[model samples]
Target: MSNLIQPGETLRVLVFGAHPDDCDVSMGGTVLRYVQAGARVQFVSLTNGNKGHQSILPVALAKRRQDEAEAAAAIFGVEKYTILSHEDCELTADLATRRQVTTLIRAFAPHLVFSPRLCDYHPDHRATAQLIQDASYIVNVPHWCQNAPIRGVTPVIYFVRDSFRYPRELRPDVLVPIDEQLDILLTALCCHESQFFEWLPHDKGIREVPDADHPEERKAFIRKYWLDVRKQYDRNRFFSCLQERFGEAAKAIGHVDAFELSEYGNQPTEEDMEFLFPFPVYRRETWKTTGQRS
Candidate 1:
């Protein structure tokens, strides 16, 4: 089905992540752009993020993570942030999980859905991908998820790029430049204090949290920490994608997010790409001759 959004339409987006901060880390900038353009977005964490902290107990950690997620959502003006009760580090692509995802899809009726790439280091990330893939078509099936109304068309699904490498590589179908939204993205990410300051640093064998009790000092450290991480993992490829699309001017873009189309959802055309991304498309000569937005 060609479920392409038209120009000037208010789009609906649903993003699924394995844990609380995953969505913000991967596509927070893109979500910011969408919201600025008046799109409605729902960020859903498939797991409770109970296991994220190195020291906090599961119950307390889960509540803390949920509160963090809510705070982050408020930063983006996203009203519908959902965290499923599934235990952290234990997500599975089982029948029940698929049904739950399908139910959410039908209830939201989003025009586009985003999830982690199938090739991921974390099992929960992999499982979340499988659940999204399994639910893509099922959401459109009449008999599935009886409590929710079946959507007439399946949402277009895209997978966020992961840092891990595999024997068979995954390539991005779209690169969304996020330079303008970098500060906002970092602010949203900072809300996930448990992950950024505690869990990730412990996982990486480094002390990420600063000793300073001042809020600005802490924010500065988190911003720099993530910027360094992004530079190490994604900066080069993101620039390459931008250069390929918009030529030399892309070098000015310092940050970006990448996404790959999934086979399980709506097949988008070139026109669909224009509608969905709405970024300034530039040809080398066009930018060189006339400094105008394409």
Candidate 2:
């Protein structure tokens, strides 16, 4: 087998989200970068997103979200997109769920794992974070997830961007510019018809919904609405760190995604950050002089 399957030989990133579109909406751009850099990446939804739709039944909504997730994964060409059968709005970080998550981490044996932060308002988001955190260490224990073999190294865990500030705000350790991949990231999000073009707009209390028949108009609306939302989350944060990695090109970067290293998992050193995030090489060090940080 290739080194990708062997533990610690390759860089593997596995991202877990509470709902179907959560991973795509949060980390899609950065995951696309990882895929481009030949690192194996996987997106897993801890819940099936059954309760995401307002009108659709839970079973049908679950299926639709799974289909949407697969479509999005194809666009990014990631290795796996797994939507667990747990119902939405009801995720709990119980032992069984912890073992289930542990199995996934053991199966992938990733070097990097990302999930939502625990400070979020959503219960499922909090639960997903708890599950991943609980599994962070057990994934390396031989007897914990008995069915799945364990890897020697514990995967580094990161919290996907969140603006919540109850206990503390998210502290970004790595900031990545994804301007070139922004279109692809947006396109990947458009795959989640139920979430982006429909449910999210309705959830946000948008009065005028995008027309379903006009795919082009819907896509355009999706782009504009999400881009506006993204600006609030991504556009204005982390200039100093981005400049350090990306050089002065950080100023021109209209779109970006960030990761906050979690205290529960492996603490990555600077070298690990360089290999894991790989922004300069992604653009092949194009800004060799002026745009580069002094």
TM-score of 2: 0.88
Per-model TM against the reference = 0.88, 0.88
Range of the 10 consecutive residues with the lowest summed lDDT in candidate 1: 284-293
RMSD of 2: 6.0
In the order shown, the candidates' Cα RMSDs to the true structure are: 5.8, 6.0
Clash statistics: count for each candidate: 0, 0
In candidate 2, what are the lDDT values of residues 157-249, reduced to their tens digit?
A: 778888777798767665666778877877787889888767787899887766667766766677688754663355576566666656776
Query: lDDT of each prediction vs. the true structure?
Result: 0.77, 0.77
Q: Give me candidate 1's TM-score against the actual structure.
A: 0.88
lDDT of 1 by residue, 200-239 (tens): 8898787646643756666667667776466335657555
> Per-residue lDDT for 95 in model 1?
96
**Error of model 2, residue 247, in angstroms:** 4.5
